[model samples]
Target: MPKADAESPQAPVDPRLLRYASASRGFFVAIAAIALAQTVVIVAFAWLLTRAITSAIDGMPVAELAPTLGWLAAVVAVRAALLWAREAVAARAAARVQTQLRSALVAAVGALGPEWLAARGSASLAITAGRGLDALEAYFGRYLPQLVQTVVATPLILVVMWWQDWISGLTVLLTLPLIPVFMVLIGLATRSVQQRQWQTLQHLASRFADTVQGLSTLKVFGRQHRAAASVERVTDQYRRETMRVLRVSFLSGFTLEFLASISVAIVAVSIGFRLIDGALTLAVGLFVLLLAPEAYLPLRQVGVQFHAAAEGVAATEDVFAVLDAARASKGSAAGSADSHSPVPEPHPAVPELVEGRLVVRDLRVHRGGGMLPPLSFSARPGTVTLLEGPSGAGKSSVFAALRGAAAFDGTAELGGADVRALAPSQWLAWAGQQPGLLAGTIAGNVTLGDPAPDTAAVSRALDLACAQALDPALELGVQGAGLSGGQAQRVAVARAIYRHLRGLAPVVALDEPSSALDAQTEARLWRGIRSLADEGATVLLISHRTSARAIADTVVHLEPSEVPA
Candidate 1:
């Protein structure tokens, strides 16, 4: 069996950041524009402060101060508006990227097929597709753009400070590198902690979903207490992992804060000495002091947001791993091959009727463990072949094999074409022992999202399957819960009959179709099966009951151990 790839317990690498870098290029440009606008506003604010102070010192006049303050207020408002626009644009871009990622993930999973999916727990997929994606919101919406602005804006701010005084500028230049260096070291540490946290979360989600799905089984077997204990153990582990994540998060924040604080202090001390020594004017000294914090601001903010976004980046890596796994071939077979020698004309024997002939030659099915014995049989048009065996005899597996589900070793031809080559919609409708019925009325369940079947056709199918007890208007609760087992089985038979009449497929396989039905209802079901055969459709019936073979034209017995137990 191909197991789901053993994903590294370490955080998977996320390409979304690179994707964000490319997809959000326009956003990056907008961020750069906003940063430039902000720099202009900062410079204007600083110059205005200086002019106001100098004029006040000279007692130049009170009236002149009003216009200066007014201009400064206008500059502040414009800066605020531009900041809002920048954030809005970045958020929209993030949403678009997230949408694209989700669609890609869904498509990749779809292509991997159900057999591949069966190897993994649903909880892991749910977490990756659902909660994991939620984590990326902050990473894309805020952290990414801020990261760009920090890299772009910080340097421009430093240049302006350098123009003011090379000493202060050089002090900033030297100290600035420390913030990111310390951040990188701390981020690396935090990454491991976040990855562990996400793993614990996936384990917990898987346990919870499995427990809920099996709740009825657990109750019937009186194993609820045991299951509850398992759940508690999982929840305890999750709690501990969560605390570990929080501890790392706080530590990362403190690391960034400490590094940034020290750098700012270094700049402040250098400027203060210059002011005392009269190497810097008081006005220029004040300006340098004001600008020092601004230069370090983006770095400090990056630290805070990075911690917030860490969980998302960690989750994204796992999602991408799933995408990578999906790129592998889902099944062993490539494509269908022609089973008939010199294939018959496209329009064959029965043009108006949706009847089909089935031919099985040296058919061998191999599940993960071993090869099931090769068996061969054929069902002519207008005949029913009964497949009989005890449970776990590979009876249903035979149906699945005919449906082109796993690696099978031989050939199944339908209407002269290989069954493997037949498109799923071509000529097979294998209804399992438990028919899947959506939540809807009897008509809805029968039609199964197809346009509503005509009333006359539906009435005939229902009457034939002996499901007249169910009202077409009555609501079938979720998964046909409102119906009795016998009623549900009859409804499934009705669906099969309806599909055959509508020409959906020429061959219909039923697995234990009468398992839940009463003797009278079972008789009615056999009548319906015979009626289908009479209409020239090929019918393959699987059942353990000896009486089921009474309605068959032939019987193929499979050993008990050949089926999945």
Candidate 2:
């Protein structure tokens, strides 16, 4: 029942939406055509009903009025059919737009990479892509169609009424402004409250997702109940906001309906007086009276549907914000987040996957509003560069910078070309501290991103990763849950090794690759890593174990950010 406001900033039909979701362009045209037909059907039904009534009043036989009555029935059926068609079209268009927006959103996130997502929490983005986009059903299926009807039907109906009887039309014209006036006034208030509701819902979703993801840690700390209570408080706040929105919606609906009814009543009374005074004929008076309600109906319905689509409208704003950011960041390579300097794309002069020699010059990683310790090293093909550092000595941060997971200052070059100019997948195969894996067969996980995977290479990579005993065909649950900590870590390293074996990546970087392994297994892993380097693949190994220094051609030690290098 909330008043629909075209003037409200949040109520704008963002032009970006049309540009992004091309499916909606044709939908508007289809809805306009249906609305025009419905407008015609409405006039025909009203005129025919007037004819039938006048004929009966004039003492015409039932046989003569049959044609008028039959035509009126046909008009009603056609109008109903058009309504059904609009609904079907709206539903289809909503689905297509939702899909298009969601796909674009995901692609944009990927283009931005983890750096941006790290700042903009993935949980909220998930909500925006999932349920937030889903809310477009009401926006497209109900609110948008009603808006089209208001635009196409209202003016046309008013024109017909004015043409039939100028007095009634003038009265309607004077009173019609009241609805939108009130709508705008009410919308100004509703806009902020509705936005609050949407934001609170997102906050609630994020909190709940965070709680679920860290439930075990919370229980261990004996703070699980506190976390649950915090979630409940957010839930209650959301509920209160929702009820407040409902109250405003109900009040707005009643106000618009009251104004529309009053306007119609005024027109009706005027028509009645004219009929009594012999100033208007039975047909004209009846036609004008019948058209009065039709003039206001479309606009009233638009306001009612606006409230229904409020959530969707808010969601679209969030979606558009992300799309806009992505568009603004277009052409900025993933690795260029730290600098505004121009980034050159991979040029033909530089051979793909050439040499895989890594040269780091005065590299400093940016983390948590501060810079990490400076690091510099050169790792060449056929050699292992053992990077030894304490826990917070920026070892993992260096890998993050090389992989475009964080912003950094200074230069990292692979094969004499700036690493920022090239994608990580082009030259670097990496396994980090976390065994990031998806639900899939072991073979599938190992061969990810390789269109044509070699089963022989998969076995070789697993053997090198010390995961040869793990069945290639074994299936994994979410986040590779079927495997133990050590097993999953080995599988992740195997995946990286598989990429290197396939010749897709020339450098294999391991971040504490054997962190979960026993001493015996760790030694085997070190041997495998050393062997890979001997085979002419550049390798960078970050390990806390001093024993790793034995395999190194170059051992680079790092200090903390606060300490002297």
Candidate 3:
């Protein structure tokens, strides 16, 4: 297990935040315009209210009220239109940012490679890529623009209030700091809650994913009830954590709302006293009273939305954690290898040519808290080396070491160059006992990441693997679900053979490649392996079964340790 480093730099701030902040420029401007429009609407409505009240007091004609009422209604209509536009623009901006974020995340994960992925389980990744990112919708679509509006519009509203009446304006301005101060305190408290919530979510997701993946195994072993109990325990913990977060969230919102309400009431009382003293006109006093709540409305909304969005920000931090881990050493390793020597040119197309000259001298593997013996072996071009050993004699460990699956001691050399020093994309292909088949047509899986293979090449490889009976055009189903074990192995062989034909690499290491096959099918598989060697590729086969030994140019045997008697 890898140890966490305390001194290591914390994961960088989420790229989504940066992307959102940048993309939200238009959204912020739109919101500012809407707020300004709303202010005009509020002032107009106040004017109309004052006009009617003063007119009633002075005994003005009732017919004269029509124009003022019409103007107030128009202001409301225009404000409604601006609000619609603002929402539309903000939504568009949010969507654009989300797309960019998802793309960046996918690219970052791709760069991390299988080793980092192995350390971080697929369930955690699924959460990050799936529901984890969904959390950001609120952060981007709602909270972000409101945050910007609060920063810009709050000051402007305060300034307008001061212009109309300094006392009420100063009251709002003085008490305004209390809202955010209280918010900051609550935010600090909620941070820990958010972190715990996110952790629980990851645990739950991982447990659920693992359970589903192992459902078949549990049923076969008569352990479905045990699996359900495990899931129930995890879900119960998740429930407890969720309740904790919600409790804190409700408390934060209640506190902020109570404080904001008090501030608004203080402003209202001050305005009312000024009106009673005749220091302020009725129109101005009512306007100030109405604008007090409007001014703080965005900030108040932010407090509530902030609690909802904290989970998203916390999850975003985890997403960045995965991306940072993936890209960590990729640059230095790739750069150092590239700077050392120019890559060799590809060999000309030939039916068969010996290229791989693998040399393993003093190779050692450390795994499961034990160090295996120093392993030394060689597989020359056009030779199949059958590696045979007892169940725990490290035969598969040798395959892993050759293919760079785990870190090891000593040197593995390919054509006189250290294998560790070789770029991973160079010189090796590995197939395990259970070959991994993604969901796709057989031809697509066979080609893997290569450019789509032509019809002829696909046909030839399938025919060679004795999978001609399997349609290349048919979908393989999830994990090759529709195929038998032997069929899957044969397709895997076809994939390796396809890569070999493409000249992508010169060596192949297979761990129990024919383990699931019967005698005849195993024979056909070994015949294909021999043909690969005959075609100038170095082949390393790991299996305990003796039948696979026939095609090997050499057989290396490993013995388990016991007291020598």
lDDT of 2 by residue, 166-272 (tens): 99999999999999888877776667678788888889988997897677679989999999999999999999999988999999999999999999999999999
The local lDDT score (0 to 100) that residue 279 gets in candidate 2 is: 98
lDDT of 1 by residue, 1-565 (tens): 2222223332222444455235556666777777778777877777777777777887877897889878878988987897788778777766766676778777766666544565677677778777777777787666766776687778888998999989889989998888877776777766666777777788888888778656767998999889999989988988997888788888778877787788888888888898899899877877777788888888778767876787777666766666666654432122111443332222333332254468888787777688788889989878899998877677877887877566577777766666544444456666777667778789987766357577777777787778877787778876677887778878888887777777777888888988987787788789878887888778999987777777899999888665443
Which candidate would rank higher by TM-score, 1 or 2? Answer: 2
For model 3, how does the per-residue alpha-carbon lDDT over 1-565 read when each residue is reduced to its tens digit?
1222323332223444654346656555677777666666666666676676776667777688677677768877887886777777767866765566567677766565444555576777677667767777777656765776687768878888898889988999889988888877777777776776677777788888778766767998999899899889988988888898899989888888898899999988888888899988877887677778878888988878887777667666666665555556566556656787332322333222236478887877766676788878888988999889878788887776666566678877776666655545556767777668989898888888687676777777777677888999888787887888788888887887777677777887778887778888778778878887898878888887898888999898888871111
TM-score, one value per model: 0.83, 0.90, 0.83
Instruction: Give candidates' CA RMSD values in order.
Output: 4.9, 3.9, 4.8
Highest TM-score against the true fold, candidate: 2
Alpha-carbon runs more than 4 Å astray in model 1: 1-60, 325-354, 416-426, 433-442, 449-466, 473-497, 560-565
Q: Which candidate model has the greater lDDT, 1 or 2?
A: 2
- Greater TM-score among 1 and 3 belongs to 3
Q: In model 3, which residue pairs have backbone atoms overlapping below 3 Å?
A: none
| Candidate 3 runs further than 4 Å off | 1-16, 19-71, 326-354, 365-373, 391-404, 416-426, 463-466, 558-565
User: Residue 190 in candidate 1 has what lDDT?
Assistant: 69
TM-score of model 3 vs. true structure: 0.83
